[model samples]
Target: MSGHSKWHNIQAKKGKVDAKRGKIFTKIGKEIVVAVKNGGPSEDTNAKLRDVVAKAKAANMPNDNIQRAIKKAAGELNSVNYETIVYEGYGPEGTAVIVECLTDNKNRTAGNVRYAFSKQGGNMGSTGCVGFMFQSKGEIVIEKTDSTDEDELMMLALDTGAEDFAAEEEVFVVTTAPEDFGKVREALSESGIEFLEAGVKMIPDTYTEIDEETAVKFQKMLDVLEDDEDVQEVYHNAEFPEGWEG
Candidate 1:
């Protein structure tokens, strides 16, 4: 599917293993709190909170940690106000990139993001600079199984309002319009389908291929931003060379 480009970030992070597990939990926790504050605490009644829970589960976050975060978010004394910010920029070789953050301090987040881009030989741009190069959509990834039928899965996904489906070697990826994401995901869940990852993401229309040297630089930029505590997600249009193992 067109949105598969975002998977590059996930694949790259796998190389780092558990080193960032705590930071990952922190980011997801902030998202859960924001979701709770925006809607309510009940996942059954709050669609966004439900998706955040699914995301937390996908990350292998501990049940106790998840329950703690939910309780804190729903408590009356929870006063932290997080703001969602999207930063657009261009990486090495003109590759488009977008960084999404949730932070209580906008100035701190902006400075951190700007430093990452500049330090990596890239430049931060205006709000819509690189945003127009990608489409916002919902992406759901399911690990492939022995009984997975491509045709059957495609039919089921489309019937449930999915926009597109692709069966990769290890996973089946489904794309849906932002508005239909929740409904489609619910339908799939009811059918006993398990998702490896699911979220609304920015998908590039086309990928920019860079040489080996530029790929290294591009990845460093991603790593710097991803390591930031306020940064939640990073999307880029860069495509690493085939067989060039991360």
Candidate 2:
């Protein structure tokens, strides 16, 4: 499968999210509580919980926050009932888009998400509308240098479990099944591989390349959704132009 960075549009917003420690903690904290409540806090037995724990650590959420979320989920402390919602739509130039959210109030969250889309010249679609256009996978990003050879990575790591591996502008994007992500990550860590970021994300099966004007609109649509309190992830079938790769 081919890959597109679209990094020029996404990097600034990622940096903004990184700066909001409180927002990051709140989102991951909710995930931890839900994961524990659903499958218990034992990562050894709970794969979903394990993923959330890893996400919490990556977000720099405090130890106490993680523990408290677990305790709350286990009934040792009070916990709120939060629901997971997936909103799908079409963005600028009719790009397929999907947004994942966790919220206690579905009505408010739904309204906000719909409004965000409409505000950016997009429209929300029914559930499962655009979901079929994407595939779910676990992805890891590692910087590329002469020291890390592509053939070596494919043979040592990708061959073992990774579904695909690609050399981006200056980084290697490693892809794996969701179930194998933890094992692959552990192996990479033991092998002394340095990584930038890793997570489970949905990759578009087909891409819609919008003109520059429509690309700006699409970026705005993504940003609005990302800024929402309930939105966890916003994905689209929009690919970056060749000129934007570097």
Candidate 3:
């Protein structure tokens, strides 16, 4: 809310994800399967599954696909197994990056992730190499419309267990403790509030500003990671220059 705008980062990621909508759907479907396997297939009984379902819907994943994913994970259809893995490293200019992956073959995922990092002038490190620089939090973004009232929305979010609320240039961001995310999300949804994006994310404690050269390399690394079938999400602390489109 202070240093770099999270909204801008979200928009940039959305742009990248939009270009490969099918890949995004596949990534989300993997998440759904993992969630169902961890908990049950029932959203009502599985909070993790419910959260992943909401994320899938936000990404415009078809309901049919969502149901199929659940059924498959629950063994009604063909069964599959995946392991969640998190890799942390330093991107160009020592910018911290965290990549969340889901893979049945850890060896292949690790090799691919390491290759992406090295190819783009980054170095993959051990699990906690850059993990300490981030905190897991729930972030919900709502696009500001003509009827949006900053004051009312702030109050509502706060009352619904949000830890912080910030109004950006074109959207309102609601932050909450990780454990309170579902409660706040459900409360706002029940009030007819729509979200542009909602999920638990690894938010950097501070952002690292990068020069144009470094930004280019950093983005290339991100692109490589995001394109990997095993990679689900990539989080970073790099702040690109003004009007940078990478």
Candidate 4:
């Protein structure tokens, strides 16, 4: 399960670098707008805004874009209201899948998501149909650099209220309670620690290994959902074959 998680994280980062940087920035920008609108433009006084800002930074979103989003949300510029929606489904071979979306038009987003699932031999399910298979937690990944000491980092994370720590081959994974995420991340940042990825994610309890053919179908479904503008995050339990590039 850890290995699969590591592989998925690496692929996600590579996907951002290879083709999805702009889309990622746009998504994070929307998140910033939502955060600012729900709270205020000032991160200092808005805890949600602070968390969004941290997420933006982790995604390498430009400071200018972040500020612009906040201004827009605060009415300094044009803004559009967005709503959060979550869809639960089963992928090929009955692997549990969950997609999180933010959109102004729920009808369009719902159609797109459902099509993505059905086109790849899967089907969208009712809310909570597959949600019970996963847990929501704050996850942080840090690269293993020459200066990174596993023991020291583990101690720091534990001392800073991290719930769990795992040292993977090329990265360190820190798990924290959802509410404690910001506090732990801030403390780690204050100590000059950098994160490759950090966000609240839905983690599956167990993984389901699939054949190559099923993996291809699953990957196609994932790609379709990920390429949708309204989609923010996609989580699943399907594990592909060793060294599967898809």
lDDT of 2 by residue, 43-120 (tens): 789878877776676566777888877776787424478899999998877889999999989999999999988987
Q: Could you tell which candidate, 1 or 2, scores higher by lDDT?
A: 1
- TM-score, per-candidate, Cα-based: 0.93, 0.84, 0.94, 0.94
lDDT of candidate 4 over 1-246, digit per residue (tens): 232255343255375454888888888888887887778789889988888888888778888988877887798334577999999999888999999999999999999999999998899999999999988888888888999888888899989999888877777888888999989988898999988788888888778889889988998898888888999999998878877777
Clashing pairs in 1: none
What value of lDDT does candidate 4 attain over all alpha carbons?
A: 0.84
**lDDT value for model 1:** 0.84
Model 3 over residues 1-246: C-alpha lDDT tens digits? 332336675355566667888998899888887887778889999999988887887777889999988887788324567888999998888999999999989999999999999998889999899999999999888889999888888899999999899887778889999999999998988888888778999989988989899888888888888889999999998878877888
Off by over 4 Å in 4: 1-10, 13-16, 76-79
Residue 215, candidate 2: C-alpha displacement in angstroms: 2.2
TM-score quality measure for candidate 3: 0.94
Candidate 3 residues lying further than 4 Å off, grouped into runs, are: 1-5, 10-15, 76-78
- State in Å the error of residue 45, model 1: 1.4
* lDDT per model vs. reference: 0.84, 0.75, 0.85, 0.84
Which ranges of candidate 1 are over 4 A from the true structure? 1-10, 76-78
Better of 1 and 3 by lDDT: 3
Candidates 2 and 3 compared by TM-score, better number? 3
